[model samples]
Target: MLNYWIGMAAICAFAMAGVLAAGRRGMDIIALLFMGVITAVGGGTLRDLLLGVPVFWMIDFNYVWVASAASLAAFALARHLRDETVWAAILYLDAFGIALFGVQSIDKALAHGFAAPVAIVMATITGIGGGLIRDVLAQRENLLSSREIYATTIITGGMLYTFLLAQGGASHGASLCGVAFTFAFRGLAIHFGWQMPKWLTLRH
Candidate 1:
């Protein structure tokens, strides 16, 4: 139950980021709402479908309600917010939501009998899937870029989390550590403009 609530809160946070992003572009409430729902449930819906499980929002309508409410609320209250504010929200909220959703999705996959590597992959997809969809639909820069190192951080943390979870004791604690690792890694990247080394970059 605690994890479920955490997941929903994370979803709402990312949804608000999406709404704020759309709102900045002069999108009306309806469009913002649409983007919010896509950002919130898009990842999890993909995860569940691939895992052959029931879709999450369809199972519990609260997810949709939370997303819609958050979108509307953010739209109403973001009038005074500047462009920098939305980017700030995107940086922090996206990192936090990625951590929460990644860990939760890993747990779900592990519970469903997936192997550690598979669970890690599942969580990686869940963590970044929505961002991928949103960036595409909004015609924004691709987030899964070698230069961004954004999705790379998620993948690294997912693998670390899966490794720790497989070590036997206190999986919950391990999960939190994983989230912290991802958040800190991303924060550092943002603060430093770190990216893959020159040697690792795709040559022109």
Candidate 2:
């Protein structure tokens, strides 16, 4: 039950983040809403398809309603927000959404009896797939090329949660720990402008 609610909140966060991140000149409300809905569910949809399971939103229409409502709310509020504020909110909301979704997806994968490595992979997808799609759709610079420690945070945090489970840790405790670590790591990386080492990037 708690995980369900957490999933919903993550959806809302991602929806709002998508709306703000993709906002641009001459974009209509329909386009923004589409971006929001896609960003909110894209990751999980991919994960489900890969896992051979039913898509979550299809199972419960409430997810779509929540995402739509959140997207519209963000759209309405966006005009009042400065670009700086919007970007700041996008950073935090994206971090929070990824953190929660990463651990939650890990739990789901494990429940489906996937191997730990596979679970980790699923978690990574669930964490960043939505944002990646949104960026691609918006034709913006994405995490794939950026130096920010984004996907790394999700992968590392998912690994931590899996490690705790292997060590007999409680699911709730491990989840909280994973989410906290990911959010803090990503948040700090954003604030401090952490970048990948030069060697890690392609040379010009």
Candidate 3:
């Protein structure tokens, strides 16, 4: 299915994020690859399990292979990424993963007879689940602290996607619109250092 390929793309994007972050922290090849695979497939794994469906990577090992290949590429290109003068690149990678995952996850859920509300919840889970795993294992910044509008944008775009699909729009157009909205919102947030005001700040 096209959703499978979309999921694969999201996996690779997240894997790149994990690999880049690991490289910044000076992780060895083995450690980087492991974390990268974990970050790539982590969200989909949890989504499948929670949905009571067969875990995707277990169904076909192609997911693992794809993840590994992406990680290896990132490892090879570490030097170039290391010279980046800004963190925006990593944030954009994360935004890409979230957007693609958000759309595909909701689409999968709808195909499985799940209603829109459930699909929305699953979209959120699939969007942020992998990055949460990566952050915990790699000790990266805690995104759940509301540091920016990351998950918020994913939620908004995902819900809009579901609404459009439910209204009988063309699948490809709707998915693209959803992905673009989420990515643009998140990319801008990263570019402008957008965050909640002091009254809403939870970080010290």
Candidate 4:
């Protein structure tokens, strides 16, 4: 299914990012690969449980293999590509993966007869859940803790996808738009250092 492939691609992208990020901390290759697999499967596993479907990886072993292979590849190549600039590459890839997963989650939720609002929320969760897990496990600050407009971008894209579906657009078409909008918003945010308005920032 389209959703499956989208999820798989996102998994690979995030896994690679996780490997690269962990490598920066001087993690061993095996540990880096383990983190990568976790990053890849964490979100979808959560999504499936929340949606009351069979955990995807349990049914399809190929997803596991793909994530594992991606992680290993990233680790093997880490030394060659390791640099301060790798952070930017990770960010961009993470954004793209998030976008894809967000749209797919929204579409999947809708197909399961969830209400639009709930679908949008689930989409946002799917987009960021894995990365949050990765950050926590890696002992890095969670992206959600920042004032950066990460989840906001996912929500915006989900809303757009939901709206288009309500307006009679095909599921695939709406998902495409959702992925595009999310990638564009996050990419712009990174390039321009965008953040939530100061008025909306919570003081510690």
The candidate that achieves the highest lDDT relative to the unseen native structure: 2
Clashing pairs in 3: none
TM agreement with the true structure for every prediction: 0.87, 0.91, 0.83, 0.87
Tens digits of lDDT, candidate 3, 1-204: 875676677677778777876555557888889888987888788888888899878999998999899899889877765566533565577788788888878878888989888888888887777768877888778568655677788889988888888799999999999999999998888888888677776557
2-44, model 2: which lDDT tens digit per residue?
7678678878888988898898989999999989988899889
RMSD of each: 2.3, 1.8, 2.8, 2.4
lDDT at residue 197 of model 3 (Cα atoms): 72
lDDT of 1 by residue, 1-204 (tens): 986787677777878877765555566788788888888888888899999999888989999999889878778777644467666755676787788788888888989998878787888788777767877787776566647777777788988888786686588789888899998898788778888788887788
Evaluated at residue 92, the lDDT of candidate 3 is: 75
Query: So what's the TM-score on candidate 1?
Result: 0.87
Off by over 4 Å in 4: 1-7, 24-26, 84-87
Descending-lDDT candidate ranking:
2, 4, 3, 1
For each predicted model, how many residue pairs clash, with residues at least 3 apart or on different chains? 0, 0, 0, 0
lDDT of 3: 0.80
Off by over 4 Å in 1: 22-26, 83-90
